[model samples]
Target: MKKLGLILSFAAALLFIACKTNPFTGKQTLALVSNSQIFPMSFQQYNQFLSENKVVKGTAEADMVKRVGQRIAIAAEKYLNANGYQGYLEGYQWDYNLVQDDQVNAWCMPGGKIVVYTGLLPVAQTEAGIAAVMGHEVAHALANHGQQRMSAGMLQQIGAVAGNVIIDDPRTLNAFNQAYGIGTTVGVMLPFSRGHETEADQIGLYLMAIAGYNPDEAANLWLRMKANSGGQEPPEFLSTHPATDSRIANIRKMAPAAKAEAAKFGVTSFK
Candidate 1:
């Protein structure tokens, strides 16, 4: 009983103190690790990653990556300032790089370090396409998805430990692990990850539009991604990202609203 009470108390403390408000959603989010704590580690990892990989420099594609990233960064700051998140980006040192790799991936780290893998360019195909994807990646950083994921993981482990302590028998503890492992992963963690992906998509669309990239092209980029994947994705419930068709549909639905948002900022034209 004492162990369980202690665990509950600790969890309550975590809930109370480890929450940060997301300026975009106007909702509190898991942030047990602050950006001040996460950023230096992220920067170090980013530098190590760049050192290990072939960071393509000075090429047109590389230049486009930096160009799109800078535009998206400015758009993010403008949107945040307009939305009353003044000084939100004070410590963010924005850096962008294109890495030579065959994996179709790009990501933004905490504090605005970004990398675009070469394998993604063929699929991106145009500046608008790059903006669409870059906006999505940047949205991940701005939204603090990495911090949330890490926090959720910590909670999941804590839950497992609490569950183990509550059951004394060896066989019962074994069964608890068996049941809790799959339940927590599928029920809590997977859904949380998927939710972040969807939110990033929506936020990215608006960011791209605000940066003068046609939001309509966001859907078009996903259509190309779907083709590249050849429709062999896991079920939406099992995947961290929505299935391709669903993602494309969601982007299509959000594009008009995204453009409307851009109009508020006097961005009536797109690149």
Candidate 2:
């Protein structure tokens, strides 16, 4: 009971004190781990990854990756400033790199380190398509999804610890472990990840539009992505992303609104 009490108190304290406001949504999100701690680690890991990988440089495709990433970063700043959240990105050291990898993936780590795999470029097809993909990845960083995920992971660990402390019977504890693992992952973690993906999709559309890329192309990009997958995907609830069809439909529906938001920034034309 005493150990359980301590665990509960620690978690409650984290819940109360470890939160940061999401600039785009104005919602308080988990931040049990601060950016000051996460950024340096992420930066180090990014540098290490670059050293081990074949980083593409001096090519038009590499140039386009850097170009689109810079525009999206600028768009993020513009939105933040216009919304009275000036200096929200103070610690971010934005870096974008193209890597010679065959995997179709792109990601932005905490503090704005971005990498676009070569395999993604063929699917991206155009500058706007790259913008769409980069915009979404950047949104994940902007919204501090990494920080939130770490915090949630810590909470899950705490839950497991608490269970171990409270349950003494071996067989009963085994059952508890199984149930807790499945319950927390499928019920909580998966949905949490999907929600982050959806939020990134919305925020990315707005940022791409403000960067003078056609928001409509985001949906088209996803269509290409879907085709590239040969139509094989896990069920939506079991996956970290929305179903491709659902994502395409959502992007199509949000494009008009994204364009309207971009108009506020004098970006009336999109390429």
Highest-scoring model, lDDT: 2
lDDT tens digits by residue: candidate 1, 61-156: 999999999999999999999999999997898999999999888999999999999999999999999999999999999999999999999898
- Model 2: per-residue lDDT, tens digit, 77-140? 9999999999989899999999999999999999999999999999999999999999999999
The TM-score between candidate 2 and the true structure equals: 0.98
lDDT of each: 0.92, 0.96
- Between which residue pairs do clashes occur in model 1? none
Clashes of each: 0, 0
